[model samples]
Target: MGTKTALITGANSGLGLATAKALAQRSFDLVLLCRSDQKGREAQADVQKANPAVTVDYFIADLADLDSVREAAGQITAKYPQLDVLINNAGYTPARLEFVDGIEKSFYASHIGHFVLTNHLLGSLKAAGAGANGPARVISLSSAAYLGGRAARFFRKIDDLSPTFAYCDDKLANLLFARELARQTAGQGVVSYSVHPGAVRTRFGADTPGFLGKVFSLAGPLMRTPEKGAQTSVFLASAPMKSIGERNNGGYFADSAPKNTHNRDINDEKAAWLWEKTMPFV
Candidate 1:
């Protein structure tokens, strides 16, 4: 039998690439997605070269654009029926406010695009669930910033949206979305999880403010490596974890262990409300 197949988005660099490497090391077939074709191809080559026996493929999908998301999801679904894992790891933290299709910037890329792509790939994940190994999992990356002190207070209201609190709000949306998705897919062999990778050294913060971005830029020594950053994400998707019923279905994880989420509003009702509000755009 072939090794299980796993698809990771934003796989050109950072946590996504590191996760790909970890999975390849375990002999999992890889499908890597990136916004740029050139970069995606390069990442694919790098992975394949590292593990000559593993199969690594690449797809181009700009999570910032809904059309690209849909097309990429469709392509993946058409080609692969049983996806053992789906890692929604792509993100964009723009320095300046930007909008796509009239929606806020961070909200669109971090939450809406992943939601749409996950929904589109639901059938394939379900197919994988039917196999002997039980259900397939969908792992979405959240952030410790979701509960980052007073800065988190700004994201209490989902309707009170803006560009400044864009990343914070979107991460909150990720938690809410994961909860509701777990509810909707209950007993279907498809479970959803949101995770915080901790404060890692990555290019994910290349667009932050003056000293902050610079300090984040030079964080290789002070912060965890990308492989360490990907531990919880990969574990949520592939680890033979402990009991995970509906109570923990949409649960959030950190440091490769389940942690109590500080975001109290990430319940079913809130997820449903946010879903209704953004359903039209996604």
Candidate 2:
């Protein structure tokens, strides 16, 4: 087959950048989606410097804005006829409640924005999967934090508006989104996987309030580095289809292995419901 192409969101920093580097080493042409043009260019330069033979391009899009997501997806689909992989790695965790387009900022950017982008590019992904040796992969970056919310009974309802619960709900939405995408596209050669990158030492929660921000910064020394955290994403992206197996097609994984997600509420029904409710925002 021809060379593969992978698009990664938030590819300028942290786990996204790490995954881009790993894919570049494997010779996959990369399209990086970054919010900042300068950072995107710098990241493109860095990846090209590391792998001179690989192709690296960047597209700027702010996930919090649905119009930006739509425009970016349009440009991507117009430019690339085939897309082998998409990693929804960009995330936001605000210290306080903030809304964008009538939805919570973190929830909107992390899950809804990605949901729209994936749907827009579904045609390209399917086309690539049809002609390639394996199915196209959609990897969503969820978190173990969803488990904590489940323990606290936060996911009992799908319409919680609390800022404190925004991040957890968003992660759960990511898992459900991936699973539902897999189910809806079954037998069509598009595969979706949600993953927990495991407490990476990246600047994820730096924007949160005093105690929370301090906690995120203090835990940096004890957490996994971005490279280590990107392992599971890279693994899911590059692994052979037969090796991954049908059982893991819509499953959540961590540390390069399929793992059980904590929330029992993340079924097809909830996934469908969330998708319907969030559609207007996209």
TM-score, prediction 2: 0.92
Q: What does candidate 1's lDDT look like per residue over 42-110, in tens digits?
A: 999887866778889888887778899899988999998889889988866657656665666676788
Per-candidate local distance difference test: 0.78, 0.84
Give the C-alpha miss distance for residue 94 in model 1, angstroms.
1.7
Candidate 1 Cα lDDT to native: 0.78
Per-candidate Cα RMSD to the true structure, in Å, reads 3.3, 2.8
- Model 2 lDDT, residue 282, Cα: 56
Judged by TM-score, which candidate is best?
2
Show the lowest summed lDDT stretch of 10 residues, model 2: 149-158
Steric clash pairs (candidate 1): none
Each prediction's TM-score against the native?
A: 0.89, 0.92
Candidate 1 RMSD computed on C-alpha atoms after optimal superposition onto the true structure: 3.3
